[model samples]
Target: MKQRLSLIIGIFIVMALSNAIVPVLPEYASEMPALQGIIFSAYFFGAFVMVIPAGVLGDRYGRAPFITAGLLLTLLSGGIILLAANPYAITFARIVEGIGAGLFVSCALSWVNMQPDHTRLSGLYFAGLNAGLIAGLMGTGILNSHFGQNSGVMLFTGLAVIPLLLSFFIRDTTGVLTNVLPPVHAIGWRNKWLYFSSFILVGISGVLVSLYPEFTDESPFILGLLFAAMNGATICASLIAPNISLQPIQTIRLASALVGIAVLLSFIAPAYGGIGGVFVLFMVIGGSIGFVFVSQMNYLAVSEKLQGTAIGLLTAASYGGMAMLPFFSGLLTEVFSYGAAFLVNGILCLLVTVTIARCRCALPE
Candidate 1:
């Protein structure tokens, strides 16, 4: 019981540290677009680079070691960001932070699902993750606005230390789930259709995650505050999500639609003046963000075998799209304007919403 409590604390710390960049990217990127984009990559590269290894290692050995190492990496990354000046420093810091995020999530979820009260534990995990994200973004933005960028980075560094403190409690788990367990059938290479369908919906969410840095630049303090607003709405939506009753595909389709509409309202009309439009945009973005994640997580939990490995794969797909899209979005902004970029991206999301709906009806239940 004590072990689980500590583990939860560790996971929350990891999330907060991992997301510290969300509100601070604008400050870090001041004249450095590459670093801003690199912030996304820092996380992606770490997660993507380590996904396969973490999976193989967690399944073959145990999930705890990876989780421990990852936490420390987060601490290292936080330290770098706190002193960051150039794009290289920022990107490198993200790389370390990403390493920790990748390890913690893949293995931590694996460990939790093995617990006696798995469903409740899963809920707690999601709750903690969302809550931490809000804290890191919100806290950093306020700190950056009042203190300076270094202070914002230091805030993450401080949070990063919290997870490492949990190392003492995570001694062993009695091997709840193990690699020796027989594997279940996976979608495999033939499931490109499933991946392609899922990928676009991820992009719909991904664009917004990437856009946050730019939005924060508009108002550093508000950027963090807006992120908290978005997460708050998402937590509410997820709470009521079960009652809404739609299968995985249907839920994702719905979320895609909401996101598309939100993007249009935010980018096209910029309704209710500048600040209000951004605020509303944040509201819309938050409400729809968790839909795809929850939907996909449900699918993975039920459909995939070697759950840890499968979750890693899911993270890869989700973050992979997130990492690449921002650079493209940046390029688009360079070519035209942020407003135009948002409109085009929103259109892309709308198109995917249609594709997913059409595919859902065609696929067997």
Candidate 2:
């Protein structure tokens, strides 16, 4: 495989494992129903706290080394999950996993962006990340259906190994040994508007995914399947996005509209249309995933000091959303029903779209 491809594959292993791991928390918590939300949030809590520091470390130490360390942690975490039965044990395992995820994404994306763009190979990295996410979720869900919860952890254990092996194939980038280096202290996060909006966008996506299971009690596996489909569509969107002359913000606006309309439709016809509506929901979800990632990173890539914090905050934003969503959405559902949850997310997402449309310039050529 090509060098970037190998790197992305390693990155994908981490991505998919992390994405798949979250949806399993609810099922795991069934053994102690009182602690579902707390257990679910534990991993993200770790991630939320670690992202900034991890980003700084990755930038200073080099992305590859951090990614290697994180993937190793993921390997260990998966093993712990396979043996864990207690809520406390499971929570600790997930926290380890979260830290691994935070380390992987921030470092991996920085490395990947260095790859030559406007070529077919450039799109592969994004697809690899999203596909890994989709695959992990979908694969885990299907495995859970066939093997049950304990086996689910083992299944991830096997999946986690692919990245570990792939990491070996990843030759260190030249930047890792470069003579010229930016003075780490020279970079600043003064560009508040760009980074903050990007973080919020990440937060909204996390909230939706974290709270999504409550919207449908079908199967925890369904969360994986639905997210898989969503990520599949996200991969497709990334490939097609550059073909159109639309500005990145314009692309985000259009994608947000589709997502809003899809969420609205999914809410109205959630169960009426059966699996088909579930698929549509994911497709819309996927588009939002593509737009948010591509657009936000595009903005942050231009920044210097903000780069590390931007990446760290970007990772933390999702974890923060994860930490808050279970409590907030759970409370909302208690008072207003799950359909209301969809409505609330839809409205907020649309509002962001409107704001972006009103202010930002089109994506640069």
After TM-score superposition, what is the CA distance of residue 112 in candidate 1 from its true location, in Å? 3.4
Among all windows of 10 consecutive residues in model 1, the one with the lowest summed lDDT is 182-191
Worst 10 residues of 2 by lDDT: 185-194
* Clash count for each candidate, listed in order shown: 0, 4
Model 1, position 185: C-alpha lDDT score: 32
Candidate 1 C-alpha lDDT tens digits along 79-182: 77767777688788777777778887777776665555554565556667778777666776667679876675676577656667766567545543564642
What tens digits encode model 2's per-residue C-alpha lDDT throughout 164-198? Answer: 77676665454333234434333333433333345
As for candidate 2, its clashing pairs are 187-305, 188-305, 247-363, 248-363
Taking every candidate in turn, the Cα RMSD to the unseen true structure, in Å, is 4.2, 3.9
Task: Name the regions of candidate 1 deviating beyond 4 angstroms.
Answer: 1-7, 21-31, 80-90, 115-117, 144-149, 167-198, 209-218, 242-246, 271-278, 336-340, 354-365
TM values, all candidates:
0.79, 0.80
